[model samples]
Target: MRTAICSGSFDPITLGHLDVIRRAAACFDKVWVCVSPNAEKKNQLFTPEQKLRLVQAAVADLPNVEAELFPGLLADYAVDHGANVIVRGVRNATDFDVEYQMAIINRGIHPQLETMLLPASAEYQHFSSSMVREMIRYHQPLEKYLPASIIPLVRDMTERKGE
Candidate 1:
């Protein structure tokens, strides 16, 4: 099977992230939507488990996609899961610059793995987890950025966190 791992901090899964996963699912036999911890990011809005649940809810309609929480190196996770590709969503040059470096590093770590960068669809290009978090903090409407299935859950989580 051609398996691909689509991973990110996913503090809360945004529409852009879901778009990439859905596209990846059409190309790969299976796609793992992994919720991982980003060492570079601080003050996460949701726990890894909460992120996983949000991811799961967002992608429930995709039969070939599975949501998981992996706190280890993505390269190692890909190797263990028999995934030969790591899929990333790139919205602009900045995203490409970072993903490009990560892809090269990931290649060095797992020689067999390839990185597939999918440009975000125009409608969701401006949507991101950080942007969503900011909106949530201000109690703004999230219907434009998050999946319908997970908006309520995201609201509940943010409310519980007293955001």
Candidate 2:
């Protein structure tokens, strides 16, 4: 079975992230929506637990996709999940620069693994997790950038954190 891993911090899974995950599902038999472990939880708007739950809830309907936590190198995570491809959603030239370098390093670490840089859909091309976080921070409208289910969860988490 061909499997892919879509790894990200996914502080809060934005619509763009979901778009990539959904697109990845169309190609790979199984897609792992793995959240990379970030030790700087305080800086993050949502805790790891929150992120996991959000990711799980967002992807629950995709029979071939799963949300997981991985703290190690992505290549190792791919190996653990038996994934041959890593799905990356590149929205612009800037994103390409970063993903390109990481793809090279990942290839060096695990020669057999491949990186698939999927372009963002036009509607979500300009949005990102950081942008969404900033919007949430400033109480900006998130109707276009975030999935409907995630908005409430972010609100609840922020309210609980007293933000």
Candidate 3:
């Protein structure tokens, strides 16, 4: 079976992320959305467990999709998970540059693994987790950028920021 790893910090999974996961599901037998815990981002709104739960809830309908948390190198995690491919979503040129550099470095570490980039859907071309977080912080409606189910969670988190 062909398995692919979609690894990200997923501070809070947004619609753009769900879009990528849905698209990746169609192309791979199994698509694991691995949430990585970054030591550098300790102030992340969602804890690793919360991120995993959110991802699981978001993709629960997808039979071939699953979510999990992993710490350390993403390439190593992919190999350990038996994934031969890495799926990434690109929204623009800047994303391409960053993902491209990581892809090259990942390839150098694991030449057998391939990275596939899917262009973001037109509606979500400008959507990002950080943007969503910022919007929520400012009390801006995020109906367009986040799944309905996630809006409440994000709202609650952002509201707590002021307390």
Candidate 4:
């Protein structure tokens, strides 16, 4: 079975991420939407558990894809899960650059695995997790960027934008 891992902090999965997952699912036999924790990052709007749950709910419609929390190196996780591909969403040149470097590092660890970059559709090409967090802080509408099911779950983060 051909399997792929879509690794990300997914602090809050966005519609763009969902779009990538959808595309990945169509190509791979199985896709894991992993909410990988990052130790270098200290401030996160959602915990790994919360992110995993949100991802699970948001992607429930996809039968071949599953949401999970992975706490170690992505190559190791891929090996453990028998995944042969790492699917990533490249929204812009910046993302491509970062993911490209990561792709090199991950392949160094597991030479058999490959990284597949799926460029985000035009509508989602301009957004990022940090940008979404900023939008939440400024009380901006999230309907255009995030999965519809995610808004209610993140009310505590976005609803109290001011005062």
Candidate 5:
């Protein structure tokens, strides 16, 4: 099977993330949406459990996609899952540069695994978890950026979490 791992912080899975995951599902026999913590993001909006739940809810419709909380090196997770590809989404030049560098580093760590960068669809190119979190903080509508399945969950959770 051509298994791939789509690793990301996914503090809150957005429409753009769902888009890339949907596409990745079409290409890989199996795709695991690995929810890893972002070391750079010290104050995450959602807890690890909440992030995993949101991701699971968002990707429920995709048969080949599954969400997991991976608290170790991505390369190690890939090996454990028997995944040979790392799927990523690139929205623009800046994103490409960063993802490309990370891809190189991941490749060095797991020589058997390769990274595949998928260009973000135009509608979701500008959407990001950070942007959605900011909007949610100010009580803004998120119908455009978040998956319909998780919109209500996000609102409820954010409110309960005191955001």
Candidate 6:
């Protein structure tokens, strides 16, 4: 069966992320949403486990999709998971440029794996986890950028932070 891995530091899974996963699921026989742990991002609210759970909750309806946490090189994770494709979501030209370079490097490391970029839906093209968190921090409405279930969690986190 054809398998693909979607890797990101989904500190908080946003609707845009879900849309990308949904699209990837339709293309690959099996899709694994791999949450990468990044110690460099100090403001991250969710741990890798927390992020995995959120992604699992968000994509629960997709039978062919699963969520997990992975560390180290993304290409290494893809190889370990038996995935031949790395699915990425591109929201703008800037993202495309960076992702393109990363894809080239990944290809150089694992020539068998291919990176596929999917454009974000126009409505969510500008939505990002950091943006959503910033809005929630300022008591702004995030009903559009996040799933209903995630709003409460974000609110709770913001409240705890006194933001």
Q: Kindly report which residue stretches of model 6 are placed more than 4 angstroms away from their true locations once superposed.
A: 157-163
Count clashing residue pairs per candidate. 0, 0, 0, 0, 0, 0
Residue pairs with backbone overlap in model 4: none
Candidate 1, residues 121-150, lDDT tens digits: the string is 999887778888898899998889889999
What shift in Å separates residue 106 of candidate 3 from its native position after superposition?
1.0
At residue 38, candidate 3 shows an lDDT of: 80
Q: Show model 2 residue runs off by greater than 4 Å.
A: 39-42
Specify the poorest-scoring 10-residue window by lDDT in model 5. 36-45
lDDT of 3: 0.86
lDDT of 1 at 34: 75
lDDT per residue for candidate 5 within 53-158, as digits (tens), equals 9999999989999999988999889999999899999999999999999888888998998989999999998778888888999999889988999989998998
Candidate number with the higher lDDT (2 or 4): 2
Clashes, model 4: 0
- The Cα error of candidate 4 at residue 32, in Å, is 0.6
Residue 91 in model 2: lDDT: 89
Candidate 1: segments with Cα more than 4 A from true spot:
none
The C-alpha TM-scores of every prediction are 0.97, 0.94, 0.90, 0.92, 0.96, 0.92
In the range 1-45, model 4's lDDT, one tens digit per residue, is 999999899877899999999999999899988889888776577
lDDT of 2 by residue, 41-148 (tens): 446888777899889988878999998887889999998889889999998999999999999999999999889999999998987787788888888887888788
Across residues 1-163, which tens digit of lDDT does each residue of candidate 3 receive? Answer: 9999998888788899999999999999999999998888655777788788778888989999999998889899899989989999999999999999999999999998899999999989977887776776678887887778777776666567661
Candidate 4 wrong stretches, greater than 4 Å: 156-163
The lDDT ranking, best first, is 1, 5, 2, 6, 4, 3
